[model samples]
Target: MNLLLAAGVLAVSLLGGARQTEAADCPFDEWRTYKNTELRRTADRKAYFWITSRTAIDADGAPKAYHPDDVGKPCGATGAGLDCPSNAGYPNKSWWPTVLASDPTNPSKAFVQPSGPAKGFFVSKTALQDSANGNERDTARYVDASTIPYLVFPRPFFQLVGTGKPGDLGMAFHLETQKQTAFIVADIGPDEPLGESSIALFKALGGNNPNPRNGSGVASGKVLYLVFPRSVDQRPRKWPMTQEGIEQGAETLLDAIGGMSVLQACATLD
Candidate 1:
């Protein structure tokens, strides 16, 4: 498949947990650069990047300035918002701030995607804070369905605070529309090791997904599994398998995630 088409599909998949933009926004085609100029006050401020495969035209027939934050509550574009539904069901509490960066190329307009989702932003707390609106502008407004076929990386690569390394352990929340329940993947392997303490933490929060092998699970290092509802149906068969297997799977999955160089590979960001 073409690169643009692949991105469009990925964007739609991610929106499954959220909402999709309208039909006019389908077949995403171009990428527009948006600058969170407000983030300039802080030394940490960096440009947020967005890739769009579709475009949207406003009532005026002028291209609309897009910001992905309009989708749901402020979930840290990182992995935090994946489970945002639990926060309040509608307005996600973890959403970050976002805005339509002024397009340097087109002085009269803001940065925009030419083809896919009409708008998307690289999310960063610094950028939102830098803006006078903070996280409210995007989070406050209802998501316009016209924007789809896009990906919202709350935090773009260059914006990560540290080395931009993936979390030692990655945590994600997925909701099966049919089941209407949340499935969380609390990755504890590679850079992030999980042990009895982490398992206990899961139990404490009333959430499941504990390391199956016990303390030895982290000895060699591995990805442990835990599922909500704690039902065998929702769990990964490999989970609770053996310490050695946990280690193997963790390594395998990490390799797929930019080889541990980008962010800790997450089993399910979809």
Candidate 2:
């Protein structure tokens, strides 16, 4: 790991949510190195393990509200001691919720629906480490690389795990589409409401591709395939907030990825 790079992440956090401000520039040396750095600095090392799953209902049974803080919380573990810098600015994680209006006649308060494929909550971890045995994949009790990509990968923007345990305010919900394709995951809290626009994200994911799996059986679940397209042909006029803006914002930000496709296509390359 580069001392200079690690120092840079620490330097950023001093500025009050610096992790969120300058995440785009963090260097990717190795996943372990990245995560180690975050664990060293943040509260939860595995917080970034996230995915797009069915929209979930909060304890109050109300829809979620879209907050960038909630989206950044998973990757925010850098503050807790994980390796990777929180808000490394990778455009990797996807957390979308519906945008509601303030009028009763308008009839859109962003509530979680009763039934649909986008019904449950989305939860996943990028790499599962057997902390007990100090084992990761391919080590008899470690996280297998081949199986990593198969478990619902996060949106192509960020590259941290969004995995949080049950009832940790570690989950997010989508309230827009009922289709199985648009579900994204986030940390859940009891008083929190479900989000509507993020639900749209749960619906926007492209189909899964056949990801290579090592000996481990981590790839057998119903996972979402995060495809970083080649050449972001478009740009965003502004940050996403509204229905159209959210998807458009994601698409625009995703387009800015450099060599994301090449790297993703040959992800196994050392």
Candidate 3:
């Protein structure tokens, strides 16, 4: 093993020992490092560990609420194309780039709906989907971020963690704060940044803002994400996960890693 992987294995082994669990035999013990983040996996294939700096706000799958008041009326005020940046000084919608697809025909304009019921709605080209609706290929409905608490991944993080697709991974918790919440791997973000979640997720984690453009912010090293690769498959396939269901799913995954005490015992990355 390389130096980084060897160090990760030693760290994980020490952590496991601290919790009195058998030392984890990490098959994919290789550690990927970013700004201040590190991720690893267990030999048992139970989870892909995430030690992230912070979690950002994501509004993609949430209801079509963008304005400060959570209303969509401003989205359709223009009657021609979606009022993408209904607010002035943001015509390009730079803060909200992930939602809009590029207009191949018009290099400057995004491919937002010109006029319709879903005119101002934003859909993730790959990650946004209603899990309860149907198969991702045929009947998958779009996710509503307001209704569901969900986690998001950077494009590269998805491949790095080895989760097959969006909605396959499960669960996230704040280590230092002890804030545990259930989340579907619901959205894919940019290539480098990580820790993006739905408005509801932010609220669950104790945030006041639901606006994607200018929501709340948290400092780095506050949130810790522990993902069970394909753990949603542990339970029966179902759409529209309920709070009770989310909690139960979280409980199950947490139990797999020996409960909160497992990581809580060693929240700091050595």
Number of the top candidate by TM-score?
Answer: 3
Q: What TM-score do all the candidates reach, one by one? A: 0.18, 0.23, 0.63
Tens-place lDDT digits, model 3, residues 11-60: 45444545443334223354567545766665677776666645666655
The candidate, 1 or 2, that scores higher on lDDT is 1
On the 0 to 100 scale, the lDDT of residue 111 in model 2 is: 25
Worst 10 residues of 3 by lDDT: 80-89
Error of 1 at 50 (Å): 29
Superposition error at 22 for model 2 (Å):
28
Q: How many backbone clashes does candidate 2 have?
A: 77
Model 2 CA lDDT for position 71 = 35
For candidate 2, write residues 1-270 as lDDT tens digits: 222232233223322332232222322222332212221111223222112222221111112112222333553312221112122221242321111112233332222223443232111112222335431111222222111111222232223343222111111111112112211222232222222122123223222221111111112212212222211223222111133332343334323342222112221221
Return the lDDT, model 3, position 204.
66
Can you tell me which runs of candidate 2 are displaced by over 4 Å? 1-29, 32-240, 266-270
